[model samples]
Target: MVCSEFAGCNEAMQGVIRYNPFSNVGFIEAMDQAMSLTPEDKERRMMLTYEHITKSSMTQWIDGFLTDLKHSFNPGQTSYYLGINFSKKAKHKKVNRLMQVRQGFKKLNIENCSTSLLRSNKCAIIIEIESLPNVKFSRHSVPTADVIETIHGLLIDKRNTIIIVGKQTRETLLNWFGRTHSFNGNELWFAAESGYLYKAGIKENWQKLTELENVSWIPQARKIMEAYVNNIDGAFIEERQSCISFNYKNADQEHGTMFIHDLYNLLDKSLKGTNTEIIYGNGFLEAKASTVRKEKLIELLLSKLTTSSKLDYLFYLGNDSSDEPVYELLKSERAKNMFFESHSNKFICSLEKKPSEADFYLEDVDSVRSILEKFYNNTKKKKKIRSFADLTKITNSIAIESQRLKKGTVNASSIANLNQ
Candidate 1:
């Protein structure tokens, strides 16, 4: 049985058996059904979802987003061709500017942008990695080995790469990045707490709170929050450096919504005139300083990178509401002026049909990997290899050549060798 909570319901609706664990009887029944299912029944159900999963090809996803973006700025030019005919003979010119953003740790697909830059001279990638969630309730921190490897490969390309993390302090992120393998001070940048803390060489920090939170507010607020949660079975509060998060995951769906509304109302009345800002997410309420935001960080990064020349192309991929501002900013006149006139792509990670500011939707983590891998494998070569066999042979040859060069074993006669 697949016990689905919030967002997993969409998966259950497709083919999987879904159960709400909050109800003992419902949970047991679903488990029984799963255990008793025949092989034929399971096969039939799995086959039903095959078409759903393969309908959106990764290439189609990228192409569709780029096509839509091309018409976005000048809709009046209805006859514009949306096809992107990547030229193999195209000269490897320095792209004046290339900027891309992705939510960190949610998925290991940041390599997609780096792979796109294999044909360019200089580019930038800004990623935001949220703080690791507390390891309570059987939740273990996942390994980021693949993520680290991808980042290292990008660093090898000698491009401007910045990783923004929600560390408690700037020094923490600095130390962490320092320990990462393949890290070079000249090639990579680190930003902590949404660009509020970052290396000075890249850009100056510009995040400023309108009015700082009162020092006494958290203590008083915690008392009221504790008193309120004491009566509720599943509600709990976690204190942070600059904010407090109220989680309602253990509550049933209906009661959880009611509890959230009541708590928001109660907190609003109790914390009136305080400087804390109450923010609502899927299953949690975060009361934080108003200055804690990602938009300013993104703006500062873009401003700093774009001064020398306008952007050649920009792409931003994110899966949260915080990402909306970044999307809106890229579509603004200021960004337009900084970009060589063309369309910019914004992709949202989504589960079901939903309204979003992004131009396209990527279904889930697997889709993220699929599209990213496609971009990573893409390269420009002068020779046209028609078959998979030919492509494989040439790719192997290039790999061997690269290995020889790295090992300082290249023969003099091979100096004049060409791909064709």
Candidate 2:
């Protein structure tokens, strides 16, 4: 369960089809069609109605009201595509700018102009005019694949664009590219090369999106684009695994800290602390958590084991400092173990089990739930037990390559060399 869509469902159950956020029609459509049917949908409507007024003369009305709703950053012409997410007060400044934009929209409308609601939030709205326009956007319409191919071809003989993304997505893409590159050795193209011989598709030429998400006509646009570009890889995770995890107590600040903190608490509580732990001290805010006693982490791991028999089928779950010590302990001769980035790619620690399975592996915090779910369904009550081999997509050429696995925890140096 790499995503939340199938969180509570049994492992034997097939995963559900989850909707994409940008399913195309528009956020306005989401407000009107998709969301209206849900309970929370009606709540947003009740709370954000503008002065009991029905919209008509876009500008004379509240053109900017909906557009400026929480609007600090303007991204794609589609206002829905942009705007920083509000998790905590981390975006108070954006909120402030959004209010200012909304006020400006109101003033413009009072002067007798016409516009229509394009997008909206509580603090801001994006208004479009029926007869005039303010912003000029370069227009191109095609499938995402076409754009990827076009750009990949364009950059083929030239330079590669550097992109940044949220850490998870970055890891996911990096893993994919590294694994693929390692197999092919050099010649790789999204359009020219199939993903793999077994199940082939366009190469995920994600490298092309870097420029669009980085270059902007305005400096603020550049900053916003940079933010998205900088965080583009943040969304990747274990695709076929039993868990979803993230640990951001160290890297995020303001709202990001709050966001990770919320997720940590949620995972620890919902999954039950028997298989999980949340690492934070009151000193984190006071900036003293840096000095906390880390020696206790080993004891914490020991406490989780009921038999004290040295973690026979363990999965070391971690993402930050609290995780490092655990990883070290798992790698020691005191235990019998093999590690995996996920459950599939075993970085065979001791050459013990022919790289076919993970006696135990290390996945970042995002994967704990999956590890536990697979563990529970496999060991606790086993009816239809599935081996790790059953989950592989084997290619005739890559089959031998699959048998070869990375040893020990997948570190930055090994990850960097994954494509070789």
Candidate 3:
């Protein structure tokens, strides 16, 4: 390659000829030198260039670009993009800055909890079931088949498994599970509508924890939201049994923001003094009964579970702000006095480790499933002999076979005779 002695030009390489592009005479001289090379020299240069090109191909270049991009977004990693090296001190500072940006989304250490669960005789797991905006099949979304099967195993084994969802109705949650796999839902519980509605089991009818009389403003609120969202492209209203949400996830950013503020004000003024409250986050605005709280439902469920027996371990997994209060409740001093043994362990995990009440954070929904599957596998009971006599008989048969082998009753000659 004949090129100017600029940034990427390696002039020392055999296949490369560098010229001062600023000097026309030098550039012409370098071009003439390149053309006058003998056949052998041309072949040698071509071979060297071919080798260099093969070593630094487009794939490698793309990979380097992507790595650099990743480092740019998630700073603090030592980057070696385009042959530029970052100093250790600089990397450390970047790392600290990244930590600050993360705002306490620390990596979850599930090993200890897994070990503790295995040793514990009884455990309960609570999972939030709301998908984050713009995320597909999020941890808070419906459970996958593997996750379903794992939870099934836990439930069949009599582990208390409760699902808490904000927007999904009990019917939708059931359908999500039913599509994946069928299992006994006797021990499983569903807390839907952010705990305003709940069902004890699959066969059980959904019961309201709070009366609908308080949420009489829902119909009017839904009508107002529906009318407001009609003008905004890609914006819609999602109506639940006791909650209505304005979803602007697909709307233009500026329009969504403007609509959210206007919608909040509209609802705030229209629903004044009604038993309803407006809450907005990320990509949506929600209006629900003011009395609906997920943490209270959890406390009620825990009280119910503890009535039968004290829990040995409790695990709570959530992905959004709605679950944050539960995390706080679980970690509170008053929670210590409720249902669990004094030495019982509790774990609060969030899908992302941002600033929150959760002590540990998982990367995504897949991580949540992976850890649960690990726990299920770790706690699975080993197969045992049906009876002691069956064990003894198997042992004696093995011993007798060994004695026969020692006596040469099962020799190669005997086998050959039998074949003959």
Candidate 4:
């Protein structure tokens, strides 16, 4: 790693000789010195260079850079950047102090969900599939292979994993999971179309939870959304089994909002008396049956699980308006009866501080993935002494071996006999 002493070359020149590239004389002298190095010195320099490069890979650098960029958003302010404040009050001083204190404690014990919590408990993890880390909400986008494998591993480890998705159809979900044949029908579950449809496993058929046999308003809503998409340049429509979404992620923000407002009013008025509702968020508007409630799906899931064993922990993650019902349900007093008195529950949103019912927030998709991966890794089973008798026997053998060593009577034959 022969480089000049420049601004960004310091890290690269750490384990090797440096040369002044600007001066011919110095560069030639440095090359000659490098050529005269001993074999041992060359090996030492190679080892150091390898270690440094391995420790500072490009992936790690990019991760650190993105993390720094996210932190620069200024969490204390409601705005994305540091600018003027139109709000009546800024972040409270006491709140900032408490946040700092909490961060310090977090650093001391980074793993909030520990192994003991998972090992001795029956846990349920309900997550909105689109909120997964790095997963785009676009119709063409799908969960990465890594994400699929990680989720499969989590399911195989015996954690009750349930996925809630709004825009994706049952066929899309099946195809996505089909890419990885490792998915088992009994291990994973799906609550598709904002909990209007439920499927217990890959092999099971989707069951409609709502009383309405058919939603006649879907075609009318789709027609209205399609007209809007045709008029808007970058807007599009995604039709699911029980939901229809008007996506404007690629459209002009100001114009998209106006278009969505008009569409929402039209759909709201047209769908009235039909038990249909409309919801709009960041860049999309969706219409679905009002009877399709996530709270009811959760209740059904708990009812089934409680018949076998009480849940000891419940973790729910979401980042959309549709997920608020589940959050509100979990916070209610009636939901507490589904778990033990010492049970733990966490409601997390995959966004920064915002108007959400979630009790905790993660910065972005990457942060969400990192936390789930940690939970998966920590909950793995570990080997331990199964019984007190086995522990006592091992301790007695160690004591006898130490005595033999101290009495100068230890030998290969004695060791073999002890082993026997």
Per-candidate TM-scores read: 0.49, 0.19, 0.58, 0.60
lDDT digits (tens) for residues 51-129 of candidate 1 = 5456646687588557656544642332122332222232331111112222221333445543444444335545443
**Cα lDDT of model 4 by residue, 82-110, tens digit:** 22211113222111101111111111122
- Which has the higher lDDT value, candidate number 1 or candidate number 2? 1
Considering lDDT, which of the candidate structures 1 and 3 is the better prediction for this target?
Answer: 3
**Span of 10 residues, lowest total lDDT, candidate 4:** 93-102
CA displacement after TM-score superposition, residue 237 of candidate 2 (Å): 28
lDDT of 3 by residue, 1-420 (tens): 687554243422447777644456768999999989999998998897676656565776577557755555443432122333222222321111122233344687778867777667678877765432224424233445666667666654445455545566777767665323334444567787778887766666777787776667888898777765767787777788788888776688897785565567568879999978676545678898878877788888788778877887888877656777888788888888777788888888877645566877777666776777767765564112224545777677666666777887765554444333
Most accurate candidate by lDDT: 3
lDDT (tens digit, per residue) of candidate 2 on 1-420: 112222322111222222222233333454455433556744554443322233324464364446556464444322122333222233321211222211111111211110111110000000001011112221111113322232222122111111111112333333332233222122222210001111111234432111112112223222222332234233211111111223222233454443433334333334342332333321121111122222232333233232322322222222223333433554555433422112221111111111111123222221322322333233312212222333342333243444443333334453334334
Global Cα lDDT for candidate 3: 0.66
**Model 4 TM-score relative to the real fold:** 0.60
- The regions of model 4 sitting more than 4 angstroms off are 1-110, 114-120, 134-138, 178-186, 250-255, 348-350, 381-420
Better of 2 and 4 by lDDT: 4
Model 4 superposed RMSD (Cα): 25.8
The C-alpha stretches of model 3 lying farther than 4 A from their native spots are 1-105, 131-143, 164-166, 178-186, 231-234, 249-262, 281-283, 381-420
- What is the Cα-based lDDT of residue 84 in candidate 3? 34
Task: Give the CA lDDT, 0 to 100, for residue 279 in model 1.
Answer: 59
TM-score of candidate 2 against the unseen true structure: 0.19
Task: Provide the clashing-pair count of each candidate structure.
Answer: 0, 37, 2, 0
